[model samples]
Target: MRDIIEIKRIGGNDVFTIGKIDIEIYKCVAEDIVTDEVIITDERIQHIKSRHPDDYEKYCKYMSEIVKNPEYIIEANKPRTALLLKSFEDEGIPFKTILRLVTSSDNITYKNSIITFMKINDKEWNRLIKNKKILYKSE
Candidate 1:
């Protein structure tokens, strides 16, 4: 018996069809490896735009704010803390969380609009956490 087959190629991959049976075959063979990746399409974009316009606008506004304030890209120091506080204020994230991440020692001081504190290196910070000198704020 001879069977008719329909083959379709989509997203740089080949799909084979024999009657109702569909199979995906690749040239390269590997064991226990993931091959297929999901691709987002224009239809999905239009659907999201139509359904969640407010969310899309909020994301754009947040990105714009970040672009406007380039100093937020710095490390976890006083200046960075101030920028993060501003970001938290805009995003409704708690200020205490931001403070906890930047505060290394109990010698944190505020002067005018800036906060100053001892900056701990990553190694020391890891050691402190390991010794339980300072509890991790995240639990």
Candidate 2:
């Protein structure tokens, strides 16, 4: 059986509620080179579920793998954001995980949190590789 990464949730007062969704922080271990701990929030998951249910259903299971060992890490157009991408097979289609570095209310500490995941077409994949600065690429 393939190993599944452990994700822990922080609840109660630590949770943040926005709109109809209650957001909780989930912490998980990512591969080295990226930060050791990766955070994901419920709000982001809901955003994906509401906007791209098909992609969410298909790629949600691979969240850990994508974040832990992306084949390509590219700089996102938005500041403090990164695009982590990996393909499951030889096909050009790939799953992308968007990670954002959020500043805590204190304004000093920052945490890396996943914002969303989606499957991108080959053309878009090629464009990303061609236009963005690749931060890392696994051999």
Candidate 3:
């Protein structure tokens, strides 16, 4: 069931507003080593749109697909975080999405959600490769 947070009367009509709703914008089983279910929420999309307009315009549609099947999965410096990357031949630049695995306060359920996504230059990609932080690479 979808959670409705607010109801406002607009033009004599009741309008529902959702705050921090758990509606799944995209859900898919990741092909990484862990193979966990990845979820992208509307809140996260707004974050991307506001923070990284250029990336949102260029790579928003590819976010779910990248998480579902990333070309490379690198271990992030933060615990329970991973950087999923996909490179397009035409673009040359790699698109990266930061995935964070968070455990609920009850400690029974988990959420693998994307914190943000952006395009990274070749230098950054090469540094990650050189550091050997990669956990998975597609064949």
User: Residue by residue across 39-139, what tens digits does model 3's lDDT show?
Assistant: 55566667878887877766665665676667877877776667777887776768878886543321343346678888889988788788856777778
Candidates sorted by TM-score, best first: 2, 3, 1
RMSD of each: 23.4, 8.3, 9.0
TM-score of each: 0.20, 0.67, 0.62
> Relative to the true structure, how large is the alpha-carbon lDDT of every model?
0.26, 0.60, 0.61
**How well is each residue in 1-139 modelled by candidate 2, as lDDT tens digits?**
1222343456531322211101121121122222334555666767888877787666666666676667887877776566877888854468877876443321343346678888888888888889988877777
lDDT of predicted model 1: 0.26
Winner by lDDT between candidate 2 and candidate 1: 2
Clashing pairs in 1: none
lDDT of 2 at 92: 46
Residue 83 alpha-carbon offset, candidate 1, angstroms? 31
